[model samples]
Target: MTDAPVRTDPSERMCPSTPKANATVFLGMITPAGRVAYVTPPLAAEVALAGLPDPTEATESRYRLAGPCVTSSCGFWTGDHCGLGERLVASYQETGVPDEAALPRCAIRRTCRWYAEQGPAACPACSHVVTDAR
Candidate 1:
């Protein structure tokens, strides 16, 4: 079988170093309660609306973004960076380790400016525990 595509550098992705003037899609912010608080960039809201389960339930939490930012070299970033790792850590602390393998694969994984440039090991937002996709 072919190996899953590897993303070696995030800097090569299409992430903008600055936020777009009219770009309305933002990443979702993970709350301390382990609930994803929809904020910024309307796209985040849309994803949250469609993807997130009821916050009141105790099921495994899904992945959520903290909002688009130029934290990596993306044009979507403002000066304020979305600390995905810290937020995720907090979420895990409050909620518990998520079923990382069960979580849907991020579409941006291949071209994610962060994963490409920084590598997965450096990502504070990603879970260190890996499970077989199969």
Candidate 2:
């Protein structure tokens, strides 16, 4: 039999590392030591942006953001899946993907693009990513 395509709920898919224009959900802050510390219950990115007097404080280097997943528009979209999420999970598999119980308390897990495509495996790898490394 031919392979059946897996259907996903596309309406709510959230891109975990979106640009400021697309960002609506504040995912978390990148720590001083360079690890992502997730924020739960999903805060609006505008609230976080409003609190920052300095524009630099709103940078991706300091905070992670999430927004509506724009497939094809994004470079990481591999037609039906997120190429970046797949790569991150594959690379991190050498270490280990966390159990569901051990995944971070993320703001957008329910609709997160990486989580939706890669399952719990994406979380551990996602925790270490910075949207803007500079």
Candidate 3:
């Protein structure tokens, strides 16, 4: 018996809440309800950044971004999977954990690091994550 090899290709895993320095896609905006109002097809991060006239406004607080997963370099990496994703799923399990059918429509899911490792369980938790650059 052999265990399947873990997929570690950086190109195939996206960080759904990356900082501006690493962001490639503007995933969504956090709405008044505090849940992410996801971008359906995904927009280029630069396009969104270019339109933001307020240089003083921090992008992380209002927008969710996606970028290549910096697995080991990321604080959320737990060697085998995302520690943050694990924690989020674990926390939600104590409450009403959404099923795969409830997953939100968003770009990068095919390659999202959390979704890849944690499956549909990551979506519900991810919808509420606001990137804290501080």
Identify the leading candidate in terms of TM-score: 2
Q: Residue 51's C-alpha lDDT in candidate 2?
A: 68
Off by over 4 Å in 2: 1-10
2 against 3, candidate with superior TM-score: 2
lDDT of 2 at 58: 83
Model 2: which residue pairs collide? none
Ranking by lDDT: 2, 3, 1
Model 3 lDDT tens row, 1-134? 12222333556688888999988887888998899999866677777766667745747888898888888998888887889888887877654656767788997787898888878888888998999887
State every prediction's TM-score relative to the real structure: 0.29, 0.87, 0.84
Q: Which stretches of candidate 3 lie over 4 Å from their true place?
A: 1-11, 53-55, 95-99
Supply the global lDDT for candidate 2.
0.81
Model 2: how far residue 24 lies from native, Å: 0.5
Query: In model 2, what lDDT does residue 119 have?
Result: 93
Candidate 1 local Cα displacement, residue 54, angstroms: 17
| Candidate 1, poorest ten consecutive residues by summed lDDT | 15-24
**Which should have the higher lDDT, number 2 or number 3?**
2
**Residue 39, candidate 3: alpha-carbon lDDT:** 82
TM-score of 1: 0.29
Give the 10-residue window scoring lowest on summed lDDT in candidate 2.
1-10
